[model samples]
Target: RKDALFEPPVSTFQPTMRLANVSGINIIPGEDTFCMDCRILPCYTLDEVLSAVEQCCAQIEEEYGVEVCYEIPQKSESPATPKDSPVVKKLSSAIYRAHGIQARTIGIGGGTVGAELRREGIDCAVWSTLDECAHMPDEYCIIENIVKDAETLVEFFSE
Candidate 1:
């Protein structure tokens, strides 16, 4: 997955630690854990992605002499919304009407409610343009964009 950099985050790892020995403030933790939010892309199967992750964990264990274990707490995959989907066309049209420009589809990752509906064969769209602060602490979007988004949605639903 050398091209992963060009894609949205198909996988994100966040490592955590549990102290087995609280000997001192400077002591190395004896146990560590990591959870991965792994999303699926058409380029690779879920099995292929997990296998690659397992291999990486194995390498870390060998290099650091630390035991490693992992589990898939949950498994869910949603089909991607095609650019030509009716829902996308309608939304794009709404955006065009609102701003006199086209709206293009791009890859985005994270837990979106649209993902659940898309899995159930719904093609509805949710979109916005914002800075990289999404999903971070105190994330925000422009107040003006909110008003514009409402206007766009009104156009979309009125169609």
Candidate 2:
């Protein structure tokens, strides 16, 4: 017997948070494999994103012998912003040129913790001095980048 009243249709609804999950396969035994996730923030433009992605891909290939892939969530649009923003344009450009890498900006179409904060009227920005080495089995941070990160934090707090 079919129970029409209790038969709810499978949801076609999509989620509202966007993310970039990265992973690497190890060709060697006993070496710690790699994986990480970046909770994306809203981006200002496509070109900015492209630049950042190019930088990331180049960096990963050089440093880890791997290529990172980007997966975009549904219904996202490329944002537009000034090409001269110090963080977006200048820093990314410098990183790419000096290291033969690429840096581009991208948007997260769905909501995130960061996005939720913004919705509650909190302002925020994100950056990293080194490749985000947050959660791999043998994860590590670069000393130089730590110093630079400290300096940047000081500068931010000063303002």
Candidate 3:
């Protein structure tokens, strides 16, 4: 059962809220509601996830005789940046100049603001040299990394 939890090929889902049955020590019964934070994968569309969730709720309602309802507060897609794009080439060159190594573009499971522009056919990248400590209590960045990243940006822009 634990393996089945992680075996799905789709995006990851984490239960973030439970509106009812907070404590299971007793039969503190009420309307049960739960929400999942879905991190979409690049391979699947938002419509696919929406359809799957709707189907799941329908099946639960049929099998359990309990009313169920759900809604997606927000949804988005982040397309991968093309490798040969001018932006990618410039950023890669700057990174090489700053670090003496080649930089490669890669897709991420997380969403980025660049996706908004990307939807409008604008070529934008969410590239950064961050250590990815976002939202953590002890999130931090090294000064050297910042300096190098600045240098890379300067090089990218100056060219």
Candidate 4:
């Protein structure tokens, strides 16, 4: 949480496992693997989160008596884009022009491809319109959202 703004930080850990292969219907599997998606806070470093995950895995291995091998397929650093930066200015202005809504700069818990670009010293911003149906059976993108996003991009490019 930010003391000055009284805003809470968003972070999450999601665990997933898949039964990739099986020897036989009745045979017990030799091992199983799972994945952990850690969306850490901007204040924490990647190494810190990784270390915490490793510790958690170790504890689970000891408590459950099952071996746990973890790997980070990808790690991205969350860097803030200055509100006054040209890219942000253009995006904010475009959003207002396209939707007549004032866009506010904010931090997100999920990692975006822009994070990679930001880590490379490039200014990047991630934006989208949604109704919170992502990854669901009824997930979909509205046509109006597509049109609005396109208009916003056009406005950004124009100026």
Q: Give TM per candidate.
A: 0.72, 0.31, 0.78, 0.73
lDDT of 2 by residue, 1-159 (tens): 222211122112234444333344434333333333333323334456568768977998899886566554333332223335555555455555444457545433333354455556544334457765564587888898877666655554544
Q: By TM-score, how accurate is candidate 2?
A: 0.31
Clashes of each: 0, 15, 0, 0
Clash tally for model 4:
0
Please give, for residues 81-110, the per-residue lDDT of candidate 1 as tens digits. Answer: 777899989999999998887886765555
Please list the residue runs of candidate 2 whose C-alpha ends up more than 4 Å from where it truly belongs after superposition: 1-113, 132-135
lDDT of 3 by residue, 1-159 (tens): 122222354568899887756577676676777788887765667888788888998999999998887777777886656768888788888888877878756655565777777778777655566786986899998898788778888888888
lDDT score, candidate 3, position 85: 81
* Ranking of candidates on TM-score, top first: 3, 4, 1, 2
Scanning candidate 2 in windows of ten residues, the lowest lDDT window is: 3-12
Q: Indicate the TM-score of model 4.
A: 0.73
Better of 1 and 2 by TM-score: 1
Residue pairs with backbone atoms closer than 3 Å in model 4 (clashes): none
Model 3 Cα displacement at 11 (Å)?
A: 2.5
**Residue 125, candidate 4: how far off, in angstroms?**
1.3
